[model samples]
Target: MIQKIPPGPVTMSDWNFVIVEYQGHVVEKFLGYYYELQHIRFSSQVIEYDPQSNTGKTWSGSKYFFLDRPGPLYPLAQIYLAHFSRNEGIRVRLKYQG
Candidate 1:
């Protein structure tokens, strides 16, 4: 599933398995569908920019949190792992037809 990212908040609905890392270290790995996941969210939020500091670090309270409020982002190359058995390529099933 590949698509152009829009210039707005992007929300992921049905997804599982999210790996969070920090400074090349694995912080946490979420393993479960969207409905089963807890606490954290998977929506894109805006970063507040400050002209004086010449940096953006602020976040919206609605979808963003820090420390106890939420978390941060980083740069890394994502690698997906799939089961390679006699079944062949990655198996996918659609729940919606529309």
Candidate 2:
């Protein structure tokens, strides 16, 4: 019998991965994953994968921050504001969803 590999643990993908740093000190890191599933909001809480359990759980709430600006907005501005208010560096990475 051929052994089968179980599915990988849940992880946020195809969004932005940001590392927050303040005054040369690492504050926190956040991962944002967005997807449209059946026209409903499908967002991951952005958690670290637990290899043993094959699941992901919320790591740190401070790591992720959501913007609630209204009207037209720019991506750069949003990021900049987030940095200034949150006081952290950001690293953006694309997540691959199959």
Best by TM-score: 2
Model 1 per-residue lDDT tens digits across residues 22-81: 355432221111222232233232345233532222133322112211122211111122
Which residue runs does candidate 2 get wrong by more than 4 Å? 1-11, 36-47, 51-55, 59-98
In terms of lDDT, the poorest run of 10 residues in model 2 is 34-43
RMSD of each: 14.1, 14.3
Minimal lDDT window, size 10, model 1: 69-78
Q: After superposition, how far is residue 51 of candidate 2 from its true place, in Å?
A: 6.1
lDDT of candidate 1 at residue 24, scale 0 to 100: 55
Task: Provide the lDDT at 92 for model 2.
Answer: 30
Query: What lDDT does the true structure give each of the candidates?
Result: 0.26, 0.33
For model 2, the local distance difference test gives: 0.33
For model 1, the superposed segments whose C-alpha errors exceed 4 Å read 20-23, 27-98
- lDDT digits (tens) for residues 24-55 of candidate 2: 65432333332211111122244553345433
